[model samples]
Target: MTQLTDTHLYREIHEQPAVLRRLLDKEEATAAALADLIHGRAIDHVVIAARGTSDNAGRYAQYVLGAMNGLSVGLAAPSLFSIYHRPPRFGNALVLGISQSGQSPDIVGVLAEARRQGALTAVLTNRPASPLADQGDVVIDLQAGEERAVAATKTYTAELAAIALISAALSDSAEQRQALAAMPDAVAATLSMNDAIAAAAPRYRYMSRCVVAGRGYNYATAFETALKLKEMTYTIVEPYSSADFLHGPLAMIETGFPVMIIAPAGVMAAEMAEFAHAVRGRQAEVIAISDAAEVLATARVPLRLPAPVPEWLSPITAIVPGQLLAMHLAHARDYDIDAPRGIHKVTETV
Candidate 1:
């Protein structure tokens, strides 16, 4: 049996802090430059084109850019461009493409069309020279280096960081910059909980399916966490906003059913605590990833995030526990931590 520590996934999971620090150091200027270009343009909204984990990052951007920068943000439907050959007008929009490898044809095509229409375009990718990058007027390098794991660990967080950095740059808020600077430390602190997460993983070794819940910015965290669990442990995990879960999906919960809640301290805290209680009342086994005392108290397994992280930035640190949980759960189930059964590192869809 290969040691989990020897796996690419494990190494990359632990490499996140350094990767974030490197990204901030190297790409802050680029992010600022992109912000400057956006400011110079007549851009009014954002259209993001991505797939898989990158699409989840776009989810985060929808909230962050909309709330922070006052820009309406929408996720682009790449199939419309790549398959149907009918692309929408991107007038007065900042069209952004995000990919780890910058090789997805559909995503690249979206940016190409946006650029051809003279829309302002930007790309967040690890590869600055790949096809997707060629379509961007500005490129924000993720700086996560070469990720060998089929499931993205560092690049996902780096993408979130790049998005946050750009939003902060657009705002030119010193407080936001300070929060961004403190993110590496927050992530490092979150990484410290790995031992506890590892110890708790075996309890869920038989977990065949579950649901992940979050609200606000961590809504993206829930989706990304579900994706990681699905990829690494082959678990049937569904992600939902806390509001959405109550509307219908709450019916899926029975006694001892597993549900992971990503609830950090912020505006969403009270509502998440209420949702935690509601699910607990339904007799579901609550596995909470949160800094809130009430939510943690209600959890059968409380995966604590480092506290005092701003709500807007919480997704970056909150997802760490979920990644660790997936990795450790895969180890418990004796699954391949590096390569999941049916996926590759770069998936180019067109």
Candidate 2:
């Protein structure tokens, strides 16, 4: 077995708490300044352009910015700007580009087009000097330091923190800021359960296919978890919102089929718990990632979140266990985790 500390992915996973703290300490003012700029504009909606793990962070933004700030949020299809010559009008919209490396030409193209149309543009990236940053009216650095792992761990959470900081700043809520301030400790508490998650991962070593479900803000968590599982364990993992799972996909759940549920204690908790119960009634093997006892009780292998977090902020902490699960599961399956096959640390799509 590979020592957990020896892998860049593992080390980056453990670096999340400090990374988040650094973001909060350094970028709160930047986020607030961006919020002030937005407030001065007639920005009516938000369009976020990202890919892969960064796209998952944009999923979280759809919920946070939409729910907290009462603005419509949409994910931008970069192909409209890059592959096709036509880019949509960005009138009265705030277009944001999110990338860890800030090197994807397509993502930069979206921001560049948005800027050309005189729309407000912002960037969330670890690389301040990258081309994606060059086009932004405001650049909020992720401040996660150097993330060497091809599978993003610290940078993903840092992106989430940057988004949440902007949301909190836009709302101008002291309560929300207080919650943001506490997030690093919450993430640290979640990380302390690393041993438990590593132990539980081997049980799913032989599992080849599964569904990961979450609702609301954690819909992103489900997708991000599935991405990690695919990247590291080479498992066929599908992510779904718990609502969508029941719409039709639930038919695939047979006896002993694995379904991972992300059901934290929040407004979506009851619905997600009900979803878990329904999956259990189908006799599927439930692997739950949750803080709620009702949800965890249903899991054959429960990966519990030790700390309580606002559902909006839950995805940031929830993904830690998912990342750890992927890392340890890959170890159990004897796959090279530090360097996943067929993928590089920085993927630039045009």
**Model 1: which residue pairs collide?**
none
Which regions in candidate 1 have their CA more than 4 angstroms from the true location? none
Model 1 root-mean-square deviation: 0.8
Model 1 agreement with the true structure over 1-350: per-residue lDDT tens digits: 78988999989989999999999999999999989988988579999999999999999999999999999999999999989998999899999999999998999999999989999999999999999999999999999999999999899999999999999999999999999999998998999999999999999999899999998999999999999999999989999999999999999989999989999988898899999999999999999998989889989998888656999999999999999999999988888889889898989789
lDDT of 1: 0.93
Q: Which ten residues in a row have the lowest lDDT in candidate 1?
A: 301-310
Tell me the tens digit of each residue's lDDT in model 2 across 1-350. Answer: 77777988888888888998899999999999999988999577999999999999999999999999998999999999899888988889999999999999999999999988999999999999999999999999999999887888899999999999999999999999999899999988998988898888888889989999999999999999999999999999999998888999989999999999988889888888889899999999998889898888888888778999888888888888899899999999989888899999988888
The local lDDT score (0 to 100) that residue 199 gets in candidate 2 is 84
Global local distance difference test of model 2: 0.91
